[model samples]
Target: MGKFFYARVSSKDQNLARQIEAFKKMGAADEQIVCDKESGKNFNRENYKALKSALGLRAGDVLIVKELDRFGRNKQEILKELEYWKKREIRVMVIDIPTTMIDIPKGQEWIMEMINNILIEVLSSIAEQERDKIRQRQREGIDCMPVKNGKKVSTKTGRPVGRPEIKKPNNWSENYEKWVKGEITAKKAMENCKLKRSSFYKLVNEE
Candidate 1:
């Protein structure tokens, strides 16, 4: 049976060194480990997909991860992936969960399965909840930013923050008038104004 490891981080800037080192300590070769520097919010990651492909994993193989949360933050999706591997006769081992890393007696394997189910349910829910909390915090932070003259301002320096407002193009009036009168297509007007669809519509609404 082959052994493989999967590691993930939430963003490109986040480090994967710790997870890689842990996998190395477990005797996984560099080629046996797949890493993704992307969010765990879903299972659409590139490296993760490659790891789950027919060429990478097979029945009787073992898939190892540093933690269950690293596998995914979506509870239902995480459970679905687990079920997929289970049906294929592949073992998924999470290092942080001691029980999952242990071997059970052949005849009593059901006991371990029951315990694993309970732990997975609880931990996956917690991971999903944590992801929701993080999103809420980000929204709150944006809402709490001070606004000055209709623009968001930094709390420290009272300076305008975030994206600068898009200004109307010099030829906007002429192009927009033509577009409104059906003399020119919206796409043509946008091209003349050098603005994208969203920006063109935003300018139109403002006018």
Candidate 2:
């Protein structure tokens, strides 16, 4: 019924203007644009959760993104959502990486769809792997930087500050591992944690 656009920037210092411009150029209305000033490596963001909950998605609704990575760094999560939206007859368009859209008749060969789905899985897997690699390299680089009396100098803030902890549900880690091992149904997990089903999956499927 409506067109939705999502844009993300990893931190407060980064601006969403470029992505907003790109989405507007794609004909997305101001009201339809959703911006998340957070990391895509984690999907449990307030803005992302809001968009999913709104589910303004119907048969012909479209989801537009500036790039595929903007969707998320986690590949399996991306592929899962893509399949979910497709089943709902929602179209997702990534401007930077097109050709992700599949055009299939009402009744067609499932094999073709399966093959395309596999490609999405593979590409997303690669994206996740690359993200991990980048994180590892960043950690190494930070470690190699000169330290002053056991404290790393801050180039931006000019004051030594510890990396901020990402707030997560208290039992998220334990619950997620347990759910993955089939210790509990997703619904039971959510009930135990007082979270939603979608939140449970988002935590469990985290990279």
Candidate 3:
């Protein structure tokens, strides 16, 4: 019965203020604006749900959003919400670059409406698939890169040049002599020796 506009931003770093400003330029009142600041992978949203509950939205009530992806990334969820609006004869306006056109279908115009819905579904599917491909490519790129700031040691290559020397621990005699002579405690001796409790005990048993 009234104009309902919804906007969304994917993260806290993003702002919905621009979207609200645009909607205001279109003559929507402040109270008519609804928003969400979260990922659009799904439609389970507090603000989005409130917008849906205000339904039975007549033929002229319009739904506005910043962009399609702002509405949702999941193809199925996007298609589902759009279809809901279409069925109720509610118009949708997307405020992208040139702003969006709102075309409400009636009578034989339903054919064009059906075609447009089909196009929206096809395009949403392709976008989601392309995003998946790009993410996979980036992950593969990271895994293939060499470990940085570390050595790739080998007998043929020797120690990697300029890398710091890594010390190996001494045997039980040195550790026990240091401890028994009160030069160090058992704990400190074990740590400096870099041996486990069981290994330290084995060394003590040997002497």
Candidate 4:
């Protein structure tokens, strides 16, 4: 029976060092290691498909993964693959789920199978549920984007949330212009402009 190991990461930028190290620790040869740097949300993994086809699995062959999530994040998909492999008489060994190891004696295969089934059900359910929760949180966050770049966001109105546009004095510019053109004294400009000293200076400098 052939021993093969699988590893995965959700994205290309994600570090694969840890998973590769785990495979090495398990004595998986360089060629025995197959990795997919893609989402575990579905089975649309290229290297994963290649691994299956390349191995041409048969009875007694084993497929190993560092963890259950590395195998899949969807409950239905993970369960489906598990049953598929089982039917083909190929054992799936997950490092974290010790019960899945194929090293057990032939006589104890049934017991290990039962235990692995139970673990798979529980772990896969939790994985899928956690993934759903994370997606929900992400949707809610991006939907509203509570705060962005230190400014509260308003996706609906396309404005800063809770902050209204500043309304400058109606004739501040006219008065400032008059002051600049020497038509009005600084004191008169300040009186007519209806702006604080800092604001008047700020607007003047801005122009």
Tens digits of lDDT, candidate 3, 52-104: 77443567687777667777778988888887887877777666512235443
TM-score of each: 0.78, 0.65, 0.56, 0.67
Give the TM-score (vs. native) of candidate 1. 0.78
Candidate 4, lDDT over the whole model:
0.82
Off by over 4 Å in 3: 54-60, 96-100, 103-106, 130-207
Q: Pick the candidate with the highest lDDT.
A: 1
- Give candidate 1 misplaced runs (Cα > 4 Å): 154-207
Best by TM-score: 1
Off by over 4 Å in 4: 146-207
Residue 74 CA displacement from its true place in model 2, Å? 1.1
Instruction: Please give the RMSD to the true structure for each candidate, in Å.
Output: 3.3, 11.3, 13.3, 16.4
In candidate 1, what residue range of length 10 has the lowest lDDT sum? 155-164
- Across 1-207, the per-residue lDDT of candidate 4 in tens digits comes to 898888998889998888889889878799988888998899989888875685466788888888999899999999998888889888888999876765789788789878888998999999898889988996776666667677768667656765453446888778878898999987788788676676667667777
lDDT (CA) per prediction = 0.92, 0.75, 0.71, 0.82
Candidate 1 per-residue lDDT over residues 118-186, each given as its tens digit = 999999999999999999997787789987799777787888877778999899899989999999999
Per-prediction backbone clash count: 0, 0, 0, 0
